[model samples]
Target: MKATRQLHDLGQSLWLDNITRSLLDDGTLARYIAEDSITGLTSNPSIFDAAIGGGDAYDAGIHAKTLAGLSGEALFTELALEDLRRAADLFRPVFDATGQVDGWVSMEVSPLLAADSAGSIAAARHIHHQGRRDNLFVKIPGTPEGVPAIEEAIFLGIPINVTLLFSCAQYQAVAEAYLRGIERRLAAGLDPRVGSVASLFISRWDVAANPQLPDALRNQLGIAVGQQTYRAYRELLASKRWHKLAAAGARPQRLLWASTGVKDPSAPDTLYVSALAAPDTIDTIPEKTLHAFADHGQLHGVLADDGGDADAVLAQIAAAGVDLDALALKLQRDGAAAFVKSWQQLLQRIADKASALEKESQLP
Candidate 1:
C-alpha cells in the first residue's frame, strides 16, 4: 500500500493544506481525493493569497464580481466560498462514510478578527452559513481572546478548526473551550455532536528555535512538543469528564498537527509526517510534503500515547537556555500577525486585479 493509505488505515487523517482554482478546475483536487486518500483540505489567507494573487485564474471572476459592485473582503469572500464549496462537495462521500468524522475543508475567519471575540464568532457563523456544507470547519485561532469565540461558535453547533496552538497548555485551553461549549449545549438540550479539532503548529517551533539551538537540539523541539501535546490529548479522551460527555452524545475534540512541512533543508522531506503519525489525530500536510510522503516516505514508528521522551527532550532544550513558555506565546502572536498581513495583501491583490480587469474591459 502507498504510505498515504498506510497512514489513513492506521487512523490518522491526511488533509492537504492547500487549495487553488487551477487544482479544482483541472481535476487535481479530485485526483487527490481518489488516489491519495486526501479526505480533506485547509486554507488560510496565505494559501488564498498564493492561489488568487499569483495568477490570472481568478482575474475574470474578480472582474465580474467587481462589476457587480462587490469589493474588498466581501468580494474575496464570494470567490473563496466558491472554491471551498466545490472542495466540500468533492469530499462529501468521505464525510458521509466517516459519519462526519473526516473529510472537512477549513476556511479561516478574517485574521483581522483574531483578537475580537464577538467579531470572530460572528464571522465564523457567517462563513459557515455561506458555505452551507456540514463538513466545512470555520478556523479560529486559539489566541487568548479567540478561545471565547471558539466556545461560542461550538455552542452554536459550528464545526471549528482551532488554529495557532503551539504547546500543551495552548492545546488544552482550546480543548477545554470546546468541551465547555459542548457542555453548554448539553445543558440547553442541544445536540452535542459539534465537531472540533485543536490544531497545534509543528514546524514553526524549530523554525523559531533554530538560530538559538546547537546541532544536537535542532529540529527536535517541535517533535517533543507534539509528543507532549499528544499525551494531553490521550488523557483528555480517557478522562471521566470526556466520558460523561461522550455518553451524552458529544464527540471528542480531536488534536491536529499543522505546519507539518519541513523547513530544514538537511532533514527528510516528510520529517513531520513520519514523526507525528498517530491514530485519531489529523495531520494537515502541505502539498509538497504530501506528495513526497506518498512517493517514498517510510515511517520508523508512530507516536507513543504516553508521549515518549517528550519531557526529556524538552528538558534538553531548556538546559540549552530556552524559555519554552515565553517562546510558545511569542510564536502564536507572530503567527497571528503573519496571517493578518497575508489577509491584507490578499485583499489588496484582489482590488488590484479587479481594477486592472475593469480597465481592460473598456478597451475592447
Candidate 2:
C-alpha cells in the first residue's frame, strides 16, 4: 500500500497545499483524491500567484473577468472560486462519506486585511457565501487582530481555516476563539456544528531558527513545536469545555499542521510528514512533499499525547539563544506580510495578462 493510504488509514488527513487550473483541468487533483488519498486542498495568495502567473492556464478566465469589469482582488476572488468550487465537487464524495470532517477546500481572505478584523470578517463571509460549497473554509490568520475576526466569522456560521499560527499558544488562542464562536451560536439557538481548523505552521519554525542553531538542533524546531501543539490539541479535545461543546453537536476545531514541506534540502523530504502523524489532525503539504512522502515516506508512530520531549527540546532551543515566543510572533507577522506581497503581485499579474489580452483583441 502507498504510504499516503497508510497515513489516511491511521486517521491523519492528507490535504494538498496547492490548487491550480491545470491540476483541475488535467484531472491531477481528482487523481490525488482517487489514488493518493488526498481528501482536501488549501490555497493562499502565494499558491494562486504561482498558479495564475506561472502559466497560461488562467489567462482566459482573467481576460473574461477583466472584460466583466472585475479587476484586482475582485477579479482574483472570482477566478479562485472557480477553481475551488470544482475541487470541492471533486472531493464531495469524501466530504459526504466522512460527514464533512474531511474533503475541505480552503480559500483565504485578502491578506491585506490581516490587521483589519472587520474587513477580514466581511471578506470571509463574502467568500464563504460565494464559494457555495458546504466543505469550503475561508482562511483567516490567527494573529491577534485576526482572532476576533475568526470568532465573529465562526459565530456567523462561516467555516474558517485559521492560518499563520506558529506556536502552541497561538493554536490555543485560535481554538478558544472557535469555541467562543460556537458557544455564541448555541446561545443564539443556532447550530453549533461550525467546522473550523487551527493551522499551526511547522517547517517555517526551523526555517527561521535553523540558521541560529547548531547541526544537532537544525531542522528540529518545527517538529518539536508541532509535538507541543499536538499535545495541547489532545488536551483541549479532552477538556470539559470541548466535551460540552461536542456533546452539544459542535465539531472539534481540528488542529492542522501547515508548512509541512521541508525547507532545508539536507533534511529528509518526509521529515514533517512522518514525524507528525497523529489521528484527527490534518497535515496540508506541498505537491512535491506529498509525492515524496507517497513514494518513500515512513510513519514511525503518532505524536505523543503528552508532547513527549517537546518541552525539553524547546528549552534546549531557547538556551541556544532562540526566544520561542518572540520568534512565533515574528513568524506570524512575516507570514502575513509575505502573503500581502504575494496578493499584490497576483493582482499585478492579472492586470498584465489582461492588458496583453486586450491588445490582442484590438489587433484586427
Best by lDDT: 1
Judge candidate 1 against the unseen true structure and give its global Cα lDDT, from 0 to 1: 0.94
lDDT agreement of model 2 with the native: 0.93
Model 1, 179-276: lDDT tens digits are 99999999999999998999999999999998899998999999999999999999999999999999998888989999999999998899999999
Return the clash pairs for model 1, or none. Answer: none
TM-score of 2: 0.99
**lDDT (C-alpha) at residue 127 in model 2:** 96
Q: Please provide, for model 2 over 1-364, each residue's C-alpha lDDT reduced to its tens digit, 9 standing for 90 to 100.
A: 9999999999999999999999999999988988899999999999999998788999889888888899988999999999999999999998899878999999999999999999999999899889999999999999999999999999999999999999999998998999999999999999998889999999999988999999999988999999999999999999999899999999989899999998899889999999999999999989999999989999898888999999999999999999999999999999999999999998898889999999998998
Off by over 4 Å in 2: none
RMSD of each: 0.7, 0.7
Per-model CA lDDT versus the true structure: 0.94, 0.93
lDDT, residue 260, model 1: 99
